[model samples]
Target: MRGVVMYKPGDVRVEERDDPRIIEPTDAIIRLSATCICGSDLWPYRGAEPVDHQVMGHEYVGVVTEVGSRVHTIKVGDFVVGSFFASDNTCEICRAGYQAYCVHRVLMGALGTQSELARIPLADGTLVATPGHPAPDLIPSLLAASDVLGTGWFAAVAAEAGPGKTVAVVGDGAVGLLGVLAARHLGAERIIAFSRHADRQALARYFGATDIVEERGPAGVDRIKDLTGGLGAHSVIEAVGTQEAMMQAIHATRPGGHVGYVGVSHDVALPGNELFMSGVHLHGGPAPVRRFLPELINLIWNRTIDPGKVFDLALPFDRAAEGYDAMDKRAATKVLLTL
Candidate 1:
């Protein structure tokens, strides 16, 4: 089987590896159809995160080729979308819609979805099959639901965005941009996206943002407050996990507003006094995508939302290196790898 491996930081290779097998009874072998690199993947590629000489890439959609005897909900030939965290649906966390925190969790990137094949453990609980079979048009939404969309949705939900609420989005990465769309779909009355880029700003408007702020840090917070009649937004989505973005989100909301944060957290340390004085509700972490997959699929199937707009660059799986480079250089909002 062919796979992309990161031998070390800045060194990524598409090479051949022994095909994976059912090492556990709950495993299921799958043939990947589409997969893409994620913004979070950059953390390791840039050497900020540890890079072991192992496989890379996580977001994927595939066809099941084999299922263990213990797996009954899914069988061979089923096309499915699995969460980054392999979980048992019946577990307490999963039952509470927090499968990403399942008692037994398997990180998706470690499983390497950027290959011709993959072995999905906890098959019945981790994978969600499309009703019967999904058409090609639905692929992107299914793919998005696996991560970015789910993350954005989680952020919006955490921020408490809903009808009559004024929501402000901080950051313009794929996830941040998608947060604009999620806030709109969730019924926010006003959305302010803080973006300076022409392309991302345009998409933010298309996603229903009523305003765009080009400022950064304090200036941005001031602008948001000015736009919201000095009360700040009722809800704020913090899609960038940096100290600045996190603080901006914390301060961009009303005294009692909620802040939804879904950026892959890094170097963030919030002081107790700051949060206490702000009185802003903060909630978000690795999105439990499993919880949103069903409704996301339904909305996509009905064409209510198109989360796939995040995919700005598409390349064959073999050119995974170029895909990574483009994103690393900020030349692409996201890169989709075609299998």
Candidate 2:
């Protein structure tokens, strides 16, 4: 089997690797139909996160080719979508809707889904079978359900976005754009997306953004407040895990509002005094995507939402390096790799 490995920052290659096989009684192996590069992958690619010949991707959607004895619900030949974090889905934390923090959770990135064949641990808990084998056209959307869409949906839900609520998104990446779509699906009355890129701004509008704020830091917060009649938004989604983006999201929410932050935090610190005075609720981490997988898969299968549109570039599996370069250069919003 061939898989993507980052030998070091700025060096990604498709190399032959041993094929995955069942390692646990609850494991399942799938032949990937499609997989894609994630914004988080860039962290290692850019040297922000250390990489030592690390396996590259986490988002995937594919057909099961093998299943362990304990994997009853998901069987060979089933089409499935799974989260970046594999969980038992039966733990106390999982029962409370926080599968991402399950006692037996495993980070799928370590297993690396950016390959022709990959093993899924805790298969019954992590993988959700689609209604049927998805058509070729729906594959991209199904693949999106694995991570970006799930994370965005979790962000919107955490922020409590719904009818009569004003939602603001602090980033313009695929997760943030899908956060816009999630806000709309949840019935947010007004959606504000902060983006300097015209293409992303257009996509934000298409996903239900009522306004676009190009400014960053304090200026972006001011724009959000100005549009909200000086009260700020009822809810804000922080998709970029930076001090600036986090502060922008926090300052852009009205007092007593909510801020859902899902970006992978990096050297971010919040001011205790300011947070105490703000009187806002903060929630979010690695999204409990397994909690929303069934619903999300249905929505994608029924074509109720089109999160797949976020993938602006597609490349063959062997050209995985090119896909990473495109994403790092910002030439593509999201890159889909075909197997």
Clash numbers, per candidate? 1, 0
Tens digits of per-residue lDDT for model 2, 1-339:
999999999999999999999999999999999999999999999999999999988998899999999888998999999999999999999999999999999999999999999999999999999989988999998898899999999999999999999999998999999999999999999999999999999999999999998899999888988898999999999999999999899999999999999999999999999888988999999999999999988898888999999999999999999999999999999999998
TM-score attained by model 1:
0.98
Looking at model 2, residue 9 earns an lDDT score of 98
- Score each candidate by Cα lDDT: 0.89, 0.94
**Residue 327 displacement in candidate 1 (angstroms):** 0.4
- Candidate 2: pairs in clash: none
Best by lDDT: 2
What is the per-residue lDDT of model 1 for residues 197-217, given as tens digits with 9 covering 90 to 100? 999999899888899999989
C-alpha positional error of residue 227 in candidate 2 after TM-score superposition, expressed in Å = 0.9
